[model samples]
Target: MLESLWAEMPDRFRTIDLESNALDTDDLTAFLTDPRGPGFRIRFGQLPADMDREMAWCCWRIAELGGRVPVGVLRSLIRWLAATVEDHPELSGSLMRAAPREWERSIAAAYARRNGSLPGRFWQENVGSTLRRCYEILWAAYDQRPWWRREVWDPTLDPRIPLRPHEPLGNHAVYFQQLEPLWLRIAIQWYFKVSLETGQLTWSTVAGPQRTALQVFADWIAGHDPVPPPWLREDPAGIRAFMLDFLSHVRGLITQSGPNKGKPLSPQRVNTLVTCLETFYAFMTDHRETAAQVLDEAGWLRLGPYHAMLWRHGEKGRRTRVVRERRQEVIDDTAFSQIMSNVHLLGEPIEGGGLGDEQIMRILMLVARTGRRISEIRMLDREPLLPLDRLCGSTGPADADGAFVAKLRYQQTKIEQAPDTVLVDAEIVAIIDEQRRWADQHLGPRWAQGVTPKYLFLGHNMNRNADKPFPPSRINQTLAVFARRLDVRDSAGRLVDFNRTHRFRHTKATSLLNAGVPLHVVQRYMGHVSPTMTMEYAETLAETHQREFLRYHKVTADGRDLPVDTRDLYDMLELDKRTDRILPNGWCLLPPRQACDKGNACLTCDKFATDASFLPELKTQQHHTLQLIDERRQAFAARTGQEMSPDNVWLAGRTQEHDALGRIIDTLEQTGHRTDSDGRAVRGAGVAARTDALAAEHDEERRP
Candidate 1:
């Protein structure tokens, strides 16, 4: 082929020279690549002997004389360089693998993945349009992040979006860095700009966080160590200490910003942050060379063994979504109480206070009782923010019956299945109604009329004073003032917080969950997208936690309904009586309905052994009595990652206690049978009769 080219252009060997130039350029690029090519050298006769000597001089000379290189010519030259032998690799693999006529079918297949599957040419023709609409939904959600407003984004240009970014929210940099570049490339696309639309940049929706992180990262690329701003610094050995300091400083600010709105991060914001960052990595990775250096270093702290270290220590602390050793934190309980106690204008000097404080308190009380968000409380349009004007103008049984049944309604929530109207239980409803009337009398007749605001708790002083509801932040700030007055000293007057309005929400959620509100129900009420989030928001009540902790090792078994009282530390220890002071670690089964009374059961039952609630105490004796029970039950219907019952919450060891108990019950029923009707049954007339006789004999022996 080369000989034929030389023969055709024998005078100058123009064709041969051009072909060699393309080859040389390709070879030269491969060499500069550090890893270099399999065998590379700067041979004198090679094309582009030195990159600078060729293009630098040509570029400089062309620019000197007011000459402009036509984009078409530049494009052709670059395309030529890309195409030669190397260009084929960049060609779409999917396209190349398919038959020419099947190319459309192949593209359709890629798109069908998004819309599920569709047959034939229908998807080929419609998927591009459908995919655009799908992305727009995501784009709209992303626009809320606000960085999309920047000038760099072109609203008109449609860009290809990759997968989401990698979010190492609580993870370290080392591990994250390995995947970070890939994630960034997925999110950011600087490849080309589209100016077809008059709207904001479409890519901005998902790329905001990645873009910000990238820009921040770019600054660090210029230098290292103690990287500016977000590029945190710390000795690996002292990372725990550094993190503690940082969290201590930042918690207050983050809390105030409402990130921890009585729950973990709001699902929307969390999704946004995670999605945006993952996409950011996707974008970065597209340019492999740039991605390697950029993403790896960016989240350096987020990667490595340090993350596991932090994770192991993350759970013992207070607060949902607790990170690796954040500095000390506590609920702004004092301020919360102060604010509520002074809800009426009766007890405190109100700063932003007024009927508004009462309204806020009432709102808080509602959230506490009903476990709803502040927004849910305020935006409840059906229920007037305040209580009714009066209970009864005239008093009588009939007149009292005339009292208005105050109820909340029209759920303004993201969840559609959630119930709308909260039936205002008696006690709180009357108080709220009275407060509204009091406010009207003080603020004037038109006050209630003018309070057409979207939110009801505002008395002024908040950033987004839309329609007059006080901003949630300002209210929280006021609450902080109370917290400062209360936590006045952290363990040692090392004053920690001012106030946080979320205390009420947390307290309420905690109370409800502790009281046994199903986490799913709580999630719906709190407007959480997931139950995991519900658990985070609901501060674990010490009462419930203690109870659970005390009885964690014990559970009902053998088809017998275990009384919850078995969980009480007081019950387990028989603290009331010195008899059961030390519970033996090994299992001990109490006789059915045979509760030991340490004098507390007298009110409910005359006999001490009658009521199940009056258990004397756990004896400090070791008896692995129930071991066989757990073994059999857990053999089936087990949920543990380990062999344990998965039923036992604290069965962290390699024991699926649920299955164990299941196995035991199956065995007890199957083998315990004395010619019984069914083998699986736990009890039979023969067993019951015998057990009763034994119990009676024991009772007689123990009788005082």
Candidate 2:
């Protein structure tokens, strides 16, 4: 059998270069000598007829002389012998029987070497587990079974056998379990594959929480004895009840890990689990025609009812759910200044007390200036930077001193509709240039050879894989370490948390909006698909609103001075408390739940409050109202030959508003507030100078 298996090997292995050939005797010989070395291993040559038997006998001898062989040497020898006969089942069986005792001794010896003591009861129980895996690998190869196929779950199996508890069940192990319907199992696996291909889901996402939901659901069904599997074709009612019960149990159950262990899941987490389960049911129902062919109409109906229950439960649960509103955290001006002042000290020798890389500082700066997502920054391709001339036609920041600006292009993964290009500062472009030179020098010849992807932020570690993009976690880790070294703290006096790199994004967006950039412009800068998302990042600061109110209230559209103090104007309109209710012409102070009784007669209503800010709008309304009053008077005269008539009662109200608006406008003009050429309110020359002095005082007061 060994000879036949060897003979069946491809002819390419017979060559010296394994990359260009198949494995042969010479390759096997070289592999055994030094498996981790540079060159390809040599294959084995012709063997004696009793080779399998001889290997088995040698294994038995090693078991008897346990302490004679060092643990490491014994492990290597067993592995080498196992690989040699892995394709020969008869030989594998013989060696499996001989190696059990030897395997135990080797495992114990290896444990003692690491911990300086023998493993206790739990380790002892799992002693043969590694040896079992070796035998299983050989058996699996001989049987030609899929690599993921493994032993089915055994309820009585010792949970402690695997030393490491809480290990999730494998895909094959979960699918082969007898409790779940075969068709349902197949459908889920198929969905997982499709999702992975479309980038709609990740393997880790499906393997972790999705699998856990299914396992917990199955366990619940099992615990209820003799209840036909909840997924059974005849049990629509049972399935619906089981789903509701499962959700309730999940909601109330406390977590067993992380900082929040022993506390019930948050609304967000509960919602996530609900979504996961709902997705599974949705997939089944979406392909109902196919599923019915396999499980029949009864089984298909079971899925529909359960899906409906999940939808209704989610809707009702959300009504009463108290989802905590989380404020977007950002690095304030003080923290940003401090970070920039000390950032250059990172990545120095340990003697200088440096504990981070300079590369992270560059990344943070890029995020601050560009407001790009961390992932988008991380996955930037080899050549991301462009010259200002290349982007002459592109929308970007204005040029300064005729100097070249930098534009970066990168894919936006989160919001797919967002644009992929952004304007960056020349300083950031210099940083990228420096990184490119460094990568070329340090990343071997791959940069020059053009054989590998030239990631701008390549990993520097030599022990692990190289020439790959740096992990986002490493960037965050560097920030955390640097933050600790500086002892950074927030306003609350707690140590500043640097875990969220997204704070830089929020900080950038807020800064741009507060600097007077229009909302639509800021939206484009931040790569937001909608203005709403941009607004979330541009949450207005109290200081910003204060400054705007002070600036606007001191002038009128026609360049006249205002008679009222801005604070009194704000008070009259209740503007500070209800900013949204203030209109250009007047303020509406009515309660939100109440209806307006005066309708369009705002100027005539006592609830209305107007100042110089309303002069232009009031003038416009007065002109229109006066024109309508004249038309109504003419109609009344034409019909009744009277200047006033009951038919003109509506006109009487309009006349009152027209007169009231005219009086308000005259008062604003007398106080020196008037419109300019552009129709925007401006303060008179004397008032403008006084307003400037007051603004300077306000600025001085706000300074640190």
Candidate 3:
């Protein structure tokens, strides 16, 4: 079976055993025992370059001493060798020479020399089993075979690619291994590889959720009786049914890991999975010829409709489900200020409330201040800091003789565009300067001797020779440790985990918006391509608006009940309308018209309403009205030579207006309404004013 399968594979996949010489017991013993021996590197190097050399050496020692390797050990070696052969086609012949048959013969000879028959037909059964397993492993590794020559039918179920141990949510590794009809797996791998190399995705994204999506599809297939491969074409309705079932399964199933373990998968996760699978089907449709042998012409015709069904499923799921009900968690103002104060003290002794290593603290501060994505900050190049004087034509607000403001320039990976540059305050510049000095003192010499990029945040793993940017995981872990040490908590008193670095981004964006920064400015600050994306971060702070309403508009003068209908309030605010009218005293409730007939008489107009907070302004206006009335009376006396003239007739109307203004002011003052020195209504004062008005009305009613 193994030989036939090998023969059936394309010429590119066939391994040739060119070595004629058989290894002696003495040579095998030295090869296994000594790390310095030629065979040690030769055999282990066939695996991943980063494979554990010590573990491989230990496995070899066990095989040498016991005369028969464990099944797990053999399987592991075969998998590694197959992977090596797949990556380096030239090494296929070398790997073939070191196959399990040679190992079995050598082990049997060693046992026979010891006057012992090989234990329990282990050589006949286990060795043959291992060889067959090796064949299966090799077939899967060769999934990148040319589209035209790929396998049309699915191979026999290989034990090497077992069913998932648990419900696979985003397990790409398992899915890729289990995905049948060799061509389909190859095409999917091709799509992802192209996507990564073409800069359509980062390796982290591809390795993570993208792979998980494929795993979910594979799991969906496995849930069926006698699982069908993804390439097996069904009608559009059949495909729709399958997709609906997959979605149902995902929704019904509980998560196996993370904070939400044992809970039903969030709608967002399900929708994301659906979107990923939809993309996968679209990729398959684009590369339809790759699966030509498996999918007939009719099947190919169904791709468009099937892809449509997948899209609809995703869209419908999103529409019907309350995906992400909770507002985005952000660092509140008080918490943010506290964090900033403590940031610089991070690396100090724990007794002094320092978490130590001020580098991470500096990173957090940078994110909080700049609104930069964590990726942009983490992947900062060697000399990313630039003086503001250099960015602007000359010395500007950002520049002060020697203490110039600086801007950070780095590649924005989220959306491919020109390098993003954001201004940093003097404090942030100082932190950057400090970090630069630290890197120069610690990482410079070692980096100069190696080939790693000059990343600002260099990895600490010198043993592994990793001189790249520090992984986001490390930064998050560091934050989590510090958060626990600080005993941080939200307003609800729940422990605040700083593991999510994104909250800093939200905190920054929300702070900017709350500070009355223009939407476009916030958008630019956040490096968002669209204002809509920035709005998502900005809009999550509904609590801020609620607090503002309670602070300013919740009460009215005269202690009158000013009940606010939320829907009416929303209409009055009219946040979505660009033409919404906001007046000095209050918003104009009237529709747009030619002119104001009331002549800015907002206090007395039925269409207008004033908060008791405007009492001082109303009093000043009344004084101005009285002066106007007296001036008109003097003019009439001079012209007609009489105390009561036609001009004086307008004075009666002016007196009535003055009396009306007095009544309005008296009502507020009588109702106990008070204003601050600036004339803004005192918070909660409206409640008192309303209480007094209600009492006065009650007294008047009783007298009547």
Tens-place lDDT digits, model 2, residues 303-365: 564553454644425533231222326666777677667777665555777754656666666
Best by lDDT: 3
Mark the regions of model 2 whose C-alpha exceeds 4 Å error after superposition. 1-106, 109-186, 198-237, 256-261, 289-302, 305-309, 313-316, 319-328, 387-404, 445-450, 460-467, 540-704
What lDDT does the true structure give each of the candidates?
0.36, 0.54, 0.54
lDDT of 3 at 696: 96
- Provide the lDDT at 1 for model 1: 25
| lDDT for residue 593 in candidate 1, whole number 0-100 | 42
Order of all candidates by TM-score, from best down to worst? Answer: 3, 2, 1
- Backbone clash pairs in model 2 (N, Cα, C under 3 Å; residues 3+ apart or in different chains), count: 30
lDDT of predicted model 1: 0.36
Q: What order do candidates take by lDDT, descending? A: 3, 2, 1
Against the true structure, what is each candidate's TM-score? 0.34, 0.56, 0.58
Per-candidate count of clashing residue pairs (backbone under 3 Å):
70, 30, 10
Write candidate 1's Cα lDDT for 447-481 as tens digits.
Answer: 32223334334333211212234345544655565
When 1 and 2 are scored with lDDT, the better candidate is 2
